[model samples]
Target: MNKQDALSIVETHLTKKRFEHTVRVAETAVTLANLYQVSAKKAEIAAIFHDYCKYRSLEEMMRIIETSYLPKDLLLYHHELWHGPVASIKVEEEYGITDEEIKSAIYCHTTGKAHMGKLDLIIFVADYIEPGRSFPGLEEVREMATTDLLKTAWMISRNTINFLMEKKNRIYPDTFHAYNDLTRLLDGGNHFEQNAIGNIETSSGSM
Candidate 1:
C-alpha cells in the first residue's frame, strides 16, 4: 500500500492516541530513512503498521499466535516478541500488504533481529523515540539516531534488557541477540558500565 492508504488503514484500526503515535513514528521514520538513504515511503508504511496490533487484547494476540506457525520457544519465552511477526502476518492476511521491506520491518520492530537493514533500524528507532515515550536518555538516543543509528540501537537494547532483568521478567532471546549483535558494533566496552555510572551521578545530582 502507498503512504496515504496505509495511514488510513492504521487510523481506522487504531485508537486516537495510537493513530497519533503512528503518524509521529511515520514522520520520524521518514527522517531517518532519508538520512540513511532508505526508501522514505517504505519507512513510513512500516512505521504506520508497526504497532497495528499493539493494542489488541492479550487474548486476541495469544489467539493469533496460537494459530500461526511461530515456534513453541517463541510462544513461551518470547511471546512478546512474536506479536510483531504475528501482526505482520495479520497485516498481510487482512490488508494485502505484501511489500517485503514493510512486512519485515513490522515483523522485527519489537525485539529486532540479526542483520537488520536500514529501513528496519529506522522503524525500530522511530518507535522507540516517538514523542510520547518520554523515558530517560531518549534525547541521547534521538541524537544518536542521526549520527550513529547502530550505537543508539545498542544502548536502547541494553537498557531494555536491564529493565526486564530488574523486573524479573522473561527476557526475549532475540533481545539478547540484538544486544550482543550491537555490542560487536560498539567496538568493545563494558556493555552498559559508563552509561549506568553516568545515570547514577545524574540522579544523585538531580536529587
Candidate 2:
C-alpha cells in the first residue's frame, strides 16, 4: 500500500499517542531514507507498520508467535521483541502487504539484522530517535542520523542492548547479532572510527 493508505490502516487500530509516534517515525524514517539514498516510500511503509501489533495482548502475541512461521531463533526471544516480526506476518496476511522489502523492514525493525538495507536501517533508527523519544542520548543519535546513519544505528543498538542488560531482561539474540552486524559494516569501512569500536557504556560499567 501507499504511505497515506498505510498510515490510515494503522491509525485505525492504534491509540492517539501511538499513532502520533508512528507518524513521527514515518517523518524521521523519510529523513534518514533521504540521507542514506534509500526509497522514502519504503521507509514510510516500514515506519507506519513497525508497531502495528503493539497494542495486541500478550496472549495474542504468543498465539501469533506459535503459528506465524517465526524462526526457531526468534521464538527463543520474548513476546515483546517477537511481536514485531510476528506482526509483520499478520500485517501481510491481514493488510495485504505483499512486498518483501516492506515486510522485512517491519520484521527487523525491533532487533535489526545483519547487512540491513537502507530502508530497514531508517525504520529501525527512526523508531528509536523519533521526535517524541526523550531517552538519554537520543539527541546524539538524532544528530548522527543526518551524516552517519549506520553508525547511529550501531550506537542505538548498543544502547538498547545495554538497557535490556541493565534491567536483567531477556536480551534478544538478534539484538547482539545486529550490533555485531553493524560493527562489521563499520569495520569494513573507514569513515566512523569511534562508532566502529561499538563502545557503549552501560550502568553495569561495561563498555
Top candidate by lDDT: 2
Q: lDDT of all predictions, in order shown? A: 0.75, 0.78
Error of 1 at 175 (Å): 0.3
lDDT of 2 at 63: 76
lDDT of 1 by residue, 1-207 (tens): 677887887787788998898899999998887777676777777898898887677777777777777645666764457668877888888887776667778988888766666666678888998877897778988888889877878878888888899999998777888888778757765434533311212111100
Model 2 lDDT per residue over 1-207, tens place = 678788888898799999999999999888877766666776777788899988888777777777757875666667678658877887778977766667778898888987676666778899999898897788888888889888898999999999999999888777888899889878885323543323212111100
Model 2, CA-based lDDT: 0.78
TM-score of each: 0.83, 0.85
For model 1, the stretches where C-alpha displacement exceeds 4 angstroms are: 77-80, 188-207
Where model 2 places Cα greater than 4 Å from the true spot, the runs are 72-76, 189-207
Query: What's the alpha carbon RMSD for model 1?
Result: 10.7
TM-score of 1: 0.83
Which residue pairs collide, candidate 2? Answer: none
